[model samples]
Target chain A: MTSKWFLKSTGTAAALSSLVLFLYANLRQPTLTEQMLPVHLKIFELDRTPQAHEQQAVLAVLKQQLGVTAVSFSQEGKTFSVTYCPDKITAEKLRAAASLNEAFKVSEKTFPPSPACPVPPLDEVKHKVLGVLRIF
Target chain B: MRKFVLYFVLALAVGMSLTACNDDKVLYEIDPNSLYSRLGGFDAISAVTDQFLANVAADNVINARFAATVANPARLQLLRNNLVDQICEAAGGPCRYKGLNMRAAHTGMNITEQEFNALVADLVAALNRFNVPEKEKNELLGILGPMKPDIVGR
Candidate 1:
């Protein structure tokens, strides 16, 4: 009788714990107010090393004109990387606004592959399951 | 023997619950048309960008920061295009941004929260010029609002 009671009590506890966890995980969902911020990065290739004045000139236009968030140049690589809000700028416009010399070449790159979109809120699925179970 | 039987039943219940939780994971569908289309597509976005830039240029607080582009028409146009593309991509349009991240971009600018707020006001004005509804404007701002930490106090 003791073993039977032990089995019954433990099984009840296990079932109860599982139900709580399932409800918590499945019901949680992000509210409408929570939105994701997006940023973009672009690189430019220069035919030759840009002079100090040239670099300054480009930086000024990028900052003042393009409203870029951050701009960096690599003297060693003869290239520059700029980070900006994509909502305000694109790689093409950044290259154009810089007004580089004829020798400079521009290439646009896409953002790296992000993981898949989040699964829908589990609460919706839970409701559907409960509804189906009711049909039995 | 009965103890083993109880353990097996408890374990089975736990396993089933775990499976149910996994099965319940659902991907919420987003309304793809909402942001992109409501903003009036590419042309309207471009027009809004133009207005926003003009507001930025006129605002004395942030105008000095934009002096480089304002002096030259070519540079000004490029800036406008950049702004439009940025907004478009952010709104889930076809355009892609290949620029730096916010923190890396705004690091040395010494931008204050006031300046950032001023910029946002200008953007709202631009959105208003085109009569972008309040809901859409709020949504757009919501998307950009998180960038404040990276942009301000740097």
Candidate 2:
């Protein structure tokens, strides 16, 4: 009788622990890997930065072909910066696409490094650590 | 303990892989149907504007209005930039028109209705030169139409 009770108790504990772990893992938000992953950026220059229409066209082509994340234009400087995932698209492909020039003069220009993600909140980190401890 | 560690490792790998896959899958998507997209974005705008400016330069009546620009390369470049910004902003493209307001800019110029009509014709010719779709062309002209009061005879 005692042995049966011990076995039952052990099974219940195991089941409860499993449930806790499953819930914790499944319910938790996945941490973003954007910080670790490298972002690729390329700049294109025109005789002058083309108008919005030309920018939009070039942006569309890049987004379709290269899966670019963002594009920023400096009209005064006549330049544009395209951000993308290097894993999905190559800078060369972006250059070739931007060179189409259906609207304005577009030639590839060098850009500065990609902007960094802001630091993660310390409170969020502490909460996550505490949650992990509770699981143990 | 060993089993828990193994399970945790497996879960971590699964979670990371799932996140990574989703990350790249939705990295970026451009709406294919936006006016800006249809007009071929900045490149197309630039091409059209360059051609339009060339046409404007050749038009005797309106060319005089732009005489100061023709005489100065820097002023012409600035004018080109402002024109592009204005058109793009009007067409709901992602550009901010930073030039002087139309009423202010044309206030003393006393631009006539004929000159205004001529400018529009030149614009239509430029749009046609680039083969901009009729729908988009008409939509662009409609957007520019409202500015006539602000631009004409000012």
Candidate 3:
């Protein structure tokens, strides 16, 4: 009976040890979801033709302060559309920064949710011309 | 009975030793640059971007905007180059981006967050078309996902 009791105790200790080890290992490794998600920013309807160098400088400042990456720009006559990552900066902050700078204008806009996949209908040759014209 | 106990103790010791040995090593550590290489380098990036842009052009909500700017093939090429540079650089690859800032380049065009999200959806599709693994895709998107704040405006 004593030996059986010892065996049961040993098994319980082993199980506890295994549980502790499992927790410790998990605690050591961080999950990917724990990291911060990236923000997307878009600036639209700017003068895309003359190529505003000063505006570019302002954008550089915003990128540095906010950790922005992947910017996109489009021009339709004098209007330009630009998009980038906002990192951790808030929209109010971006607005305040742009407001302080005379070279750029913040359009009345709202943050839009990103799509999970690219749109396909626009790629068709028949729709290409019309599609290109519309974004402008 | 004593022999069985001894054998059990020995097995336990061996198991503990093996666990200790593995404790020093990590189970997964993905190399970011190598992940980019597997995605087909610049060519693959360009292809995906091309497909993405094409999709953007078709999206009714933002098709007008994408079409206006990316109409010219030459302009599209420039845009593709800039985008590829940014993606490659973000993915820990060897590439320097020489494109304009997001806000300055986008000022006055009036892009809504919804439109930007649509573009991202198209991008995700492109990545899927290229068969990028989920982990790597998430990693790449993590690099690109932050751009939402800069792209959405509000």
Q: What is every candidate's C-alpha DockQ against the true complex, given to 2 decimals?
A: 0.04, 0.02, 0.02
Fnat per predicted structure, each in turn: 0.00, 0.00, 0.00
Off by over 4 Å in 3: A1-136, B1-33
Q: Write the per-residue lDDT of candidate 2 for residues B50-151, one digit (tens) a residue.
A: 667755654544655655554433354456656776776566565656567777767766778998998898788878878898999999999889989997
* lDDT against the true structure, each candidate: 0.59, 0.60, 0.52
lDDT of 1 by residue, B68-115 (tens): 444333344334544665677788775554335677656767887888
Output the worst ten-in-a-row residue range by lDDT, candidate 1 chain B.
B21-30
In order of appearance, the predictions have TM-scores of 0.42, 0.44, 0.42
What TM-score does prediction 1 earn?
Answer: 0.42
Interface RMSD of each: 17.2, 18.2, 15.3
Predicted complex 3: CAPRI docking category = incorrect
Output per-candidate TM-scores for chain A, rounded to 2 decimals: 0.49, 0.47, 0.38
lDDT score of model 3? 0.52
Q: What is the TM-score of chain B in candidate 2?
A: 0.78
Which tens-of-lDDT digit does each residue in A1-136 have in candidate 2?
Answer: 9999999889866765565455454544432221122344445666655566766776677657755655544425366555555788877777777766445556655323322111224533533453454432
**Residue runs of model 2 more than 4 Å from their true location after superposition:** A1-136, B1-31
For residues A12-131, could you state the per-residue lDDT of candidate 1 as single tens digits?
A: 777656554454344434111111223344555566666788778777877774547555554353555565667777767888877655435554322333221122235335434533
